[model samples]
Target: MPFIPHTEEEVQEMLVAIGAASIDELFDEIPENLKLTQLDAIPTALSEMEITQLMGKRSLQDGEPSCFIGAGAYDHHIPAAVWQLTTRGEFYTAYTPYQAEASQGTLQLLYEFQSMMVALTGMDASNASLYDGASALAEAVLMSVRANRKSKSKRVLMPRTVHPAYRRVVHNIVRNQQIELVEVAFDPKSGQTNLAVLEQYAGEDFAALVIPQPNFFGVLEDVDALTNWAHANGALAVGVVNPLALALLTPPGLWGEAGADICCGEGQPLGAPLASGGPYFGFLCCKIAQVRQMPGRIIGRTVDLDGKVGYSLTLQAREQHIRRSKATSNICTNQGLMVTAATIHMALLGSEGLERAAAASFQNTRHLVEVLTAIPGVEVMFEQPAFHERVVRLPAPAKGILRSLAAHNVLGGFDLSADYPELGNALLVCATEKRTEDEIAAYAQKLERVIQLQGGVTCGLVPKE
Candidate 1:
């Protein structure tokens, strides 16, 4: 139970080999003040049977509430088959397919993942995967800097409405890279990136401009205008997009239609569970010209001497493992298991099914928004078009309202006031395809009651009785 397998003699022998008299001697370098004098509050060891019963009792107390939260991670429907397939010994236990010959299955799945990403983003090439969306954006920014060797742009512009974590990741990656991170402000009225501000910073010295599709506020930005502005200034446009939103909204490749050079984003909604925050995958796709600068691994199809179709690691020389510091990024592992799960999920859904799922989410969210805004004290934050998420101005403090919603067994939306002070009393609500009509209606009704009971109007735009 405790995994204390070493006998006393074995432990004494190990200590002798290390020139230590006892285990405590190994910690002699640590100061006494920093050492714990007593054990933690956890209970003493129990029999396995007793531990199981205790754990079962605690687990029963933790109930799963219907959730509405989706700032970055979402609660979309994951197919049962996805779990069954991903847990298979081949896909689940395998690590990096370092040797291409021994890992044909892993390599082929990576290849399929690349193909799906290419189709989804409308890009010429795609990498196997990265850590997550934020890291993917960081890698894309670095790649742009590398690709523009002659131009030597030292500035990168991102909109304020991009995910806060992503913005932080960019800052962290660029700190020692001698690059200036410029965050452009968004339009308060439209909740989209301010193109005029973008124009001011979009010069030859600017490396790339990152914009989120259906930005953090869930307002869809004018991709065509943003891309044109970035390109006209000789900078690349990097799109941080929602994979599900790509179903109804145009894919980032369409942004390429608008002149985008690189497209990257989180693929969590594709099938990956929001297990806490992750085990998520970051996708990077770009035009052929920028392929060499792309971080992470890429698998390609080839033929053997017998002329049979074969798969092998194609873009080896571009990564850190092969090229060291000169490589595009230090990332080595491709998030193989997560990528495989997403690939399998996408394969099952296909293009048409994905589009339909996206449409359902959009419709459900819009319906909920309309119902919530109808209440006396609630107000829609922006008139801009959105996908499955929307921001609403709350009559009462967002925290209080969220607490009340929680009491009613709902996981409420993210409170924007936590990050954007200007958006005081604003809550960012999200609805996925998993939300039933009854659940949406009930949430809206509960929100209305909570605000009204707190001496706040239900619809902010309406006159008090």
Candidate 2:
């Protein structure tokens, strides 16, 4: 891939050798209609320095926006060493381990990742990793249907409290299939999945019930009651969780009397930086019996002929591995690099460090809620116990307030109108451990100023009846 400079004389000589007058003549065999006569839309090429300066100036427009938005992706502090070590040539350039014996290092790392995920979720087994949280949830839905041998139903109950993006991805992926995805509404006051509506739909005809922990609105669902209800109705309970929250809250596997059948979530909060939305991994864990139906690769540890320990691909459900028509899943590879980053992050922040981080995030969010709610026209919308994010109703439209906050270099959470239209002028705000006290205060000050200038009035806190 080294650059080679060709001279005009060299080109002319080559053209002459090929019996062509010019480069255009070389492609004379091609039809004229197929050839592009011009590319006027593309800009003229610029010098290296000019291009660099232009890019730098454009990037400066982004400024230093204090992020409070956490609809799904978060802004968490990542240790520098996590990527420093992960980017090593050995780990960076490694590819799919088709030959399991030859990929001991990769297999071992993935095995460790799976082990950590299982321990974190309190599940019997974990897959290597998946495309992302949304797709992982979709895969979890498919697995639930497959695992529910007793049920002849293809219906799944998805909560409105789940991230709208995640739900959309699931619909797009599974819409062509015969499966029916039923939406369960949430309590407008509590912002949690309405247990009343849930009870009506929770029955034998449903394949699974997808529950989001510290759901899209950042309101914690009554997971115990929901899981128990799902079990009682002979439906699999699929918990869409936040991996970081598991540090302080109870794991899905330990929920209810019976426990969640499957657990999956976004792992961006682990150690991955929010590099403009992504490159984050998704994790899925399940009971031991459902391991066979799980998607993606699974690495396992065993002993060799000489009694030496070895690591290899334990199960590959993708079409590439097994019979194409009979394959359990079509996912060929796991998000190896992201998994590597997450494994290192988990190791760096052991159990105690993770607990501290989680506790700090919760406290920071509470602080944010207090300061923001003190504003004249701001109020907390939900009374439920939340982890590190909350929903707040604003007198003015959230979109307008967010734009005003951006003018002050602050990203004031996500607007809830589009997703939850009934929650008028609401915003989903988060304060991870990375948010400083000063940032919270500044956000409050900016928000109050914005609301005042807009002549907005408060409805105060709604009665939690």
Candidate 3:
């Protein structure tokens, strides 16, 4: 979105028509001290042509770098036909199918999305979508508390291995509602949540237990054990999974004997880009019994008067039309556009294709770890098996090493110092299927140079196993 300048006369005319005396009146709610008097850093007005030229020159300053950071959003390859088909007028301009008859195409697309999610997660039902992964987790936490009729306590066992931002969002959304998020610490050595810690809460009445497949540190957890443990204590198993990883890893529904009650995760890797942290949608799925508790729109396939197959909004017990008390959640709008794109992405890449991509990602990450650890003083931080991302300890401060890598046109990895301070200078690195052997080698070469520049101490190479 480009900035369009307005004429003073046009601005004044618009302001007068809107019942505002001046621009300042519109922002009366903003604190007097907080409002900036002027933006001195902003350059003077330039012609469109001049601005375009200047932007081109500035854009070149930040050369294209190999991406290795996949904390939440990934850098997976989207097929060419994905966006091409998604942007078609019929799909692009379609809004929520409030009147199912008017927006059948949109409803149908959403239904397909839900069906695909069900197949992927092995859940009985799926909602259209919520805002993003973080908000989706908040909704899942809330849903667990409401659906757990057996448990009296609103406590949910949230492991420290869950995404930090997601934990914060869950706390903010659920705390006021008296929902307690009990934080469970991870194993310092493996960067995984051990069952021994979970044993402490064996008899406690908790509404749910969140189990991340490859947790925040990217270490794969024992999902079957965790899910079974949650069920043994009469708690709902809430799985926060990576959709891409679900291609190869066991899904939430197959985790234990009964499987996870609810599953949710970010749908960004499906088709959405890392367009400045995104417009990514979050998907929520649950068993048939818990379908009534799931939030967001749920589209159902049905027969018309003519006995024609059709799509319709189903089990909607939330927002504007429903009574406040009866509503499951306050999720207002649907992430229909993102969901549509993801559907197209999945359609283009069938299950076999997704599995291949997942396998490639896992192999590449393992190879990357092997390559990176070969360097002196650089070692794998965790001893557990991981998916595409893993935490690796750098000999020097991660931030400085990352900055140096950036100068060499490489995005090394995400620095986890501030978030996980105990793991000093630990860098959370990822190598998706998109990363080639050459790219991985280049990253390692530049990283070694950076370490040498920092006078990194030479040490015996630590085995990645």
Candidate 4:
């Protein structure tokens, strides 16, 4: 029932009926310190029309800028029909397929999502989805510790080249699980994981080694060497990948003579957009033997009683569904809406279209690097081949230059100094297929102006930390 205003007589009668002298007496059991005296910070309620106008004005502040900033989340062009079809009442409002009989449509879509991810990663099987890329990687690490029979140690080797945010998430989630994470350094010159350092720890009693392809620096790693080394040492090779890059680069499953045991990555590049930070899904794929250890839910195809084809919820290892101790993961729900969009996108753009998109992104990124490095004080940090992102050493602090660029309505790349303080004045920039020649030219011109205005420091000299 809706709340209605009470008359003074009725209020007094209710107070008398409840044996309370005043409204304040109703809360006599509560402590004084726990009670709020006034709400000083909250503003007075505004009219609907007034609020609508205010919100609209603020929304305009997020207008499309010439975006180049891609640390992990990317700006990909999502088709209009993708969301329109995904957000239908049936798909958008559907809940988890707890009762498989009524959720055929949702289950079928997720099955398709799994099939596409498996083909892309060249893995044996894939789960429906997970929270996001960071948590997915964390879950994959936890799975390795349980599934790997050769090494019983709780130690995992993590490369510094992995996205710092992902590393932090892994630590935050698994730190209390008695897992030991050893940090491996990257080669300063090539911006790849230091193979010598990795080799040093390869023989250790580690359960898994986390390798990032087109690592956080955007430089491709020696996947073949790393995968072979990890497997030879009896540790599972966990590949943290960018799904789009798989179209052009080698898939994780084909990394070495053996193959990567597990693969996890952000699925945003496939179909999800950079909605500020996200609403993106994470995909996890692994060998068939490790399917039981995989987290979240997996949809499987089968035949009905009459021998007709159908889809249903298959593997669910969540604590909520199974015994707590036996559960492989505690992840509650998959990002269903995001997965729906991703599946539709992959279907729309078949294998050929995906490859073309990945190739174009690589070309655009190379062109962007060439233009940025043309400036007197700008220099590319790594000579190794990269995908869609590159580290460029800047004369001054990248944050300051980026701020200046923003005034020109350009979203420059991420400031590496924030996460990688050792990098000094480096900025990690990306150029996706969505970028145009005009946008790249404009970014170059604006960047050159910023460098000159800031009194271009010597080339190759980063400002001292």
Candidate 5:
């Protein structure tokens, strides 16, 4: 809507025509206690140039910090065209697709999103989208329990290597619903799930087993073995994956002979920015046999009366429309806006472009590990091959070192002491393709200088370019 400020004369004429003396007289029905009569907190409005200058000063105060943390949200480079096209009025101001005939564009976009997710995860079908990665995993857990007719137990074998925050969310959401999350431990050496410990529960009945590729510690897991074992025990294999890593790693659909039954993961790395925490959508895809059990809305493409191509909502399980007990899920609306950006991002960067970015990220992470380990007391914490992130053992306390790094305008990796106390003084670092060689060297130099200082030590700051 365009703003057209009224002239004082025009306003007075309108007031006279309405039999009012002033604008305040038009609201005479309001009670005295309901009105606010002061504007003391607000400053006088400034001119355009003055406001622009003031904002520039504020932007300078908020320095552009270098990002090396990728616990769940990533800092991948987005193509300029992705957001440029997505933010156009047609896509940006769109709302829910309640009317199929009038909402063809929105419905088609969602249908394309599902198709892309199906291709990426190698699953039979995919819903529009879910809340975020953590909640999606929680939903996947519940879905597996309901879909597994072979096992009556609501027990799920959850690996300790999955993201700690995700586990907390799952427990909070499903604990009161009679779901039991049995945590499986990891091997200290490889940072991978211990197959020996898993063998102890060979014949036990469980609904599903969650397999995280490049588990929380960033170490790749034996996914094929885990998937096979889950199937042998009459359990469904649910894969918690990173969509970007799927460019180089094996898709969950081909994990074993019969393949993983379901796959779910965070979609931040696709195109969404890590603005503080997120606005990223979670993707869930499963085999055709269990499509009815999936949550959220699914868009289906079909031919109309004139043989025209069309898209419409299918298998909607809203609580308002079905019996309370028979409704498959409580998921109502899909995250259409976030998924729109992801679809554009994936389309711009075809399969080959995504592979190159993944490969570059892996190479940069490997190089970062080497550069940091060259310091006298820094070393890799795990022996298993990792993707783009790794847990490094630091000589000094991780919390203090990270605080000191922030002073240098560098946002270091996450400290694992609070979550996994067993790995004492460990830091999880990552190197996205965005990190330049100069940035890596500067980080190493500052880290080495910080490690050498016992007491109060003076260090030079390296301003970010």
Candidate 6:
């Protein structure tokens, strides 16, 4: 069927009503030079089966490469049951779940999700979900401003160690709001937040301090010291975290326990695929006092007339639909499906399973790091303990090294020099539970070979595969 809804006469009448002589007039705002002047080089139509086969073939090209890439998003294990249950028509097609009476299941799922996030983050309260990690951080910054009773200066202190894209999101969301963003630099030797430097910038004018747990370089920051510092300055401490790492590391709520006011993170590692970068969930959790300032919807458990349990959207004061300028945020959609999937995955794994997965990823990554650093020209960038990722300084240019590794069908880690110039020729490698020991060993061998090919030789050892 044609996608256009109007009949020819209806289209003509609509065009005439709009004072346009033809359909092309509707697109007059588009520059004439930019308009397509010729038909595409390929046929416009294909049989459904042909299209399917074509798509399948295109997808196969992705497998021709091995993926070792991780900056924020990771390739992790997803159980078959997660897909099977999520794909059902009842869950897959559902959205909003606005009609609480009709959306009990969805609301309950969101409630459970919120509950899980609260437990994972160690925060007093959690929202249903946000757009993704970056937006969540942005929202948390805004929430900090709202929580500061004495501050009108909308200044936020964010460390350079936080994900680069996340910092960009903060700029995008806060720029028009007249918020001032101050970037705190990391210690050159440690690759972690310089608390002394952060303290120098801390003041009454600042609304919040944003730090990433197991920051972009994969070094875990001292949350206790940082959170205390932020609080001492009367600023909220916001911890941007990786959800999977929470399985083994201290939860951000513990940061709250240490005095952080807000905690938020990317939930992508929790059963959400990279999907070429996103459509993942951003989770926000905070002290109960900041619930009114939270940016997204909240689902609460209630009771029915018969005294049975029920769930409904509650505490929606922050949403724009309810209050225009008074709204805490303009975000309306809750990222329902993605949040649901994460919630289901967490529930399926429970605490013990999640801990095991985290442990395996940690052990595997440590082993890989040991092997890679054994290469003469390669050195571990941060000797600090990491959760599932690490950074290595390469004797050769990182881009050249990555290209060489790619030739051998191994996707290399993110090159830090692309963003951190000081960390010259460094690559941030990540391994998850999904990576096998053989894969790790193969990666080390390939990296060694790539380094040697670049005319860089490792010290004190003969090459062995």
Structure candidate 5, residue pairs in collision: none
User: 40 in model 5: Cα distance from truth in Å?
Assistant: 11
Deviation in angstroms for 39 in model 6? Answer: 9.5
How many clashes in each candidate?
A: 9, 0, 0, 0, 0, 6
What are the per-residue Cα lDDT tens digits for candidate 6 across 107-176?
A: 8888989899888888888988888999999999988888877667699998999999899999999889
Clashing pairs in 4: none
- Residues 1-465, candidate 3: write the lDDT tens digits: 147588889999999899899998999999989988787899878888998999999878767689899899888888989889889998888777888898998999899999999999999999999999888999999999989999988999999999888999999999999999999989898888978999999999999999998898889999999999999999999999999899988989999899999999999989998876789999999999998888988999999999999999987655546747678887768688889999999999999999998889889999999999888778899989999999999887899999989988899998999888989879999999999999999999988888888877453434334
Mark the 10 consecutive residues where model 3 has the least summed lDDT: 456-465
Residue-wise C-alpha lDDT for candidate 4, range 1-465, written one tens digit per residue: 125588889999999999999999999999988999889899977877989999999889787799999899887777788999998999999899877779999989899999999999999999999989999999999999998999999999999999999999999999999998899999999999999988787567889999999899999999999999899999999999999899888999999988999999999998887887678988999999999888888888999999988898776544457757668877677799999999999899888878988888889999999999888778899999999999998889998999999999999999999788988889999999999999999999999999889886555455432
Q: Which ten residues in a row have the lowest lDDT in candidate 2?
A: 456-465
Better of 2 and 4 by lDDT: 4
Taking all chains together, each candidate's TM-score versus the true structure is 0.88, 0.89, 0.87, 0.89, 0.87, 0.89
Q: In candidate 2, which residue ranges exceed 4 Å CA deviation?
A: 1-55, 317-319, 458-465
Residue 128's lDDT within candidate 2 is 87
For candidate 1, what's the RMSD? 4.3
**TM-score of candidate 4 relative to the true fold:** 0.89
Which tens-of-lDDT digit does each residue in 333-387 have in candidate 2?
6689999999999999998888989899899999999999888768899998888
Scored by lDDT, model 4 comes in at 0.90
